[model samples]
Structure formats: C-alpha cells, structure tokens
Target: MPILGEFREFIARGNVIDLAVGVIIGAAFNDIVKSLVDQVVMPPVGLLFSGIDFARLEWVLKPDNPATKANELVAIQYGAFLNTLIKFLIVSWVVFLLVKAVNVIRRRDAQHPEATSSAPPPQEALLMEIRDLLKAQAGREEPPTRH
Candidate 1:
C-alpha cells in the first residue's frame, strides 16, 4: 500500500484515535484546572492568609543590580510550585472521578449485556422459548406408577 494509505489506516485505528482525543482533552482540561487554581482558588486562599500573593512569594539568591545593568538575579518560587501542585491535585481528582464513573458504567453494561446490544434475533428468542417450554413439560410429566 502507498505511504499515505498506510498512514491513514494507522490513524483510523481505534486506539490511535482514542489516544489522540485523550491528549487533546487532557491539554484543555489542564489549562482549565491551571486557570482555576491561579485565578479562583488561590486568590481566596491568599486573601485568607493576609492577602499574600503566592506567585510573588520567592527567595532571592542574588539581588538585582541596576547600577551595572546586570540582570543576574535568581530566586526560588515555592509559591508558584505550590500553585502548580494544587492544579495537579485537582486534575488528578477530576480524572479519578471520571475513571470511577466510566468503571461504574462498564460494570452496569457488563451486568446487563442487553443494555449495550440489541435483543437476540427472533429465531434465537423463539428457540430459547421452546427450550424453556420443553423443560416445563418435562417437569410436569408424572413419574411411572409402581407395579
């Protein structure tokens, strides 16, 4: 097959498509969680902590020098790290919830296979009914009388 056709077939496979979709959704979800942590969640927490800004919370290793126009300044931004940690935790929790929901749906569908698929064909249904009727008749038959 041609290279284009081969590429098309690979992309069309279920796992590949699902993975691509997952990556896209994960990226978007990460962005949303990051935004929530940065804007909504942290602000209130910071306010509760005496209006502290987490992003600006850092340790200066070398102070900035404006006399020599030297931009050599280093700092450890532990607050930013905390914000990122919170975002990660939130995203993890959301993923866990989603996975739990999917597992529940899978279990339910497994328990009731008919829910996921259409009913048996008419002939199959009729055969099952006949088998049940024959079993019923066999059960109803009287035992042979003793001599």
Candidate 2:
C-alpha cells in the first residue's frame, strides 16, 4: 500500500483514537496532579520541614559572580525533584485504581455475560436454541411421531 494509505489505515484503528484521547486527558490530568502537589500536598509537608519551598530549594554547585553578575548560578533542584516524584506517585496510584475498577467491572461482566452488549441478536439466539433442540432430539433412540 501507499504511505498515505497506510497512514489512513493506522488512523482508522480504534486503538489509535483511544490512545490519542488518553494522551490528551493524561496531559490535562498531569497538570491537575502538579497543581495538587504544588498547592495542597507540598505546603504542609514543607511547613513540617521548616518553611522549605521545594521549587526554590536548590544547591549552588557554582556560585554566581557578584563582581559583574556575569556567570549565572548552577544548582541542583532536589526539592523540585521530590515534588515531581510525589506527583508521579499520585498519578500512578490514580491509574492503578482506575485499572482495578475496570478489571472488576470486566470480571463482573464476564461472570454475567448478558450484562454487556456482547450477547447475540434475538434471531441468532433463537436459531441457536432450535439447533440445540434438534441435536438433542436427534440423539434420542425413539423414532419421530407426527402429531
């Protein structure tokens, strides 16, 4: 197939669309989680650690030159890293919970198959029932009788 045709085929798959939507929502969710970590979760934790702002908590590997302010300060921002780690944990926990819930629902649907829309149509179901009945009747040793 042509390259454009292949691209079209790829885009047409349901999984691709689902993945695109997931990525978009995940980005938005990431922002929310970041805000929660920055505004709500980190403040009390920082207060407990005696007024340390994680974003500003950095070690100056190379001090800035006060003479001319020519060379900028280079530092390792470990506090920001800690905040990011907390955000990662929160997001992971949420995703885990969502997956667990989906699995539970999936198991319930599997056990009660009719709970989902995967059941055959009424016409197909009736045909299957008739086929089974015919098979059972055919297995009998008795001859058929006309009513």
TM-score for each predicted model, relative to the true structure: 0.74, 0.75
| Steric clash pairs (candidate 1) | none
lDDT of 2 at 16: 100
Candidate 1 displacement at residue 51 in angstroms: 0.6
Please list the Cα RMSD from the true structure of every candidate, rounded to 1 decimal place. 10.6, 7.6
Highest lDDT scorer? 1
Query: How large an RMSD does model 1 have?
Result: 10.6
lDDT of 2 by residue, 13-97 (tens): 9999999999999999999999999999999988998988887888889988898757788999988889999999999999999
Model 2 stretches with alpha carbons more than 4 Å out: 117-147
* Each prediction's whole-model lDDT (CA): 0.93, 0.92
